[model samples]
Target: MNDLALRGDNIVKRFGAVTALDGVSFTLGQGEILGILGDNGAGKSTLVKILTGFHQQTSGTLSVHGEETLLKSVDHARALGIECVYQDLALANSLSIYHNMFLNREIVRRGPARVFRLVDHKQMRERAAHLLEDIGVHVPSVDLPVERLSGGQRQAIAVARAVHSNAKILLLDEPLAAMGAREAALIIDLIMRLKEKGGLSIIMIMHNYAQTLDIADRIMLMQRGRVTYEQQSANTSVAELMDIVRREYRAMRATTAQ
Candidate 1:
């Protein structure tokens, strides 16, 4: 398999007359976490959408696992081992922890058709319990629905699901947004664990530069629908990154101040 999990070249997107993304290009390496930094409306979400197959690029190309493949939809992204954990983790509140973890990809007994094929609930529960333990998630029980679990636990389950799927490239949009300090730390620790132990490559979108700098191997900054700066975490300082963000913010404000 190719170590370069995702590569976007001069990606462009537009909504009617408004251009959301303009010539965005980047590559994500295996087990490397790349932070995407940009203010609101800087085409962060748009770029993510294009990568995840939620939206097609107006121009340029996207590749998965070194092959130039078109992502027609979210399912296509998943098929390419590109799993995304959106900030709003769409875990079903009514489903059990195991159910939520497996979701549509439930383990089932082999049969001729769908007449007597049974869901392996016991196996799934055992797996879910093991996964939670492996990920250091302290959930009360796998039998409980996700609605009853705390926010941190819910997020952990979401992350655990990604691990179970053996995702090659993980896209996390604002993972720590709206999280308390403790919860945020827990999630960050999980991210680190995934990177170190599972060798999962991740693209984390976060406004908290300090936290991102601590975790990411590299950071890419986007401004006005374009990538303005890119730096390795070892070669860059938080102060320098902040300066870039501030400069972009000021430039944007000045543009709109007119």
Candidate 2:
């Protein structure tokens, strides 16, 4: 069996006269983390949206587990074992940690009361706590409201929810943005632990070069709706990535100066 978790080939997305992505292609191996880097409006978000089935590509092909597939909707993506943790973190602020963890997929007791669809709150709470602990997330209590938690703790809960869903491919958008150093380190440790566990493939959209270098097994850089650079993280340096961005910026400045 091929170990590819997800593969995108010659992906292109356009809106009227705007091309948000142009012939972007990449492959993610099982248990690997691929960090995507780009300046604002570089089509990073666009590609993520497409991959998560928020939008359909104008052209290109997507394969999951070596089989050609079309992700029809976000629900469809989830059904296919693909899950994304967007920057918004999408938690119900007033909901308890366990409630947020179960969200729409609440557990129902299997009995006469099952017809009423009574949510098994105890089961959910226990499972939520176990999931967090499994992911190395330390929380005060599963009964606590998510809004009460710090930003990093909330992010960890979101990631733990995804893991609980048994997602084969996880897409994370700006997981570390706006976090303090300690908070960022917490998420980084979680990601490293996830990688060590094996079988979960991750594609992380990152703006921090150092963070990306530290956590990503491979890196893909995009610019103006195209992939400008792709290389193994160990083989590339921050200076090399910065140099590429600098040259692109200089070229843009020269064009604007014309």
lDDT by candidate, in order shown = 0.87, 0.93
Q: What's each prediction's TM-score?
A: 0.93, 0.98
Query: How many clashing pairs in candidate 2?
Result: 0
Tens digit per residue, CA lDDT, model 1, 154-221: 88888889878978788888888888889889999989888878667899898888898899999999
Pairs of residues at least 3 apart in sequence or in different chains that clash in candidate 2: none
Show where candidate 2 strays beyond 4 Å: none
TM-score top scorer: 2
Best by lDDT: 2
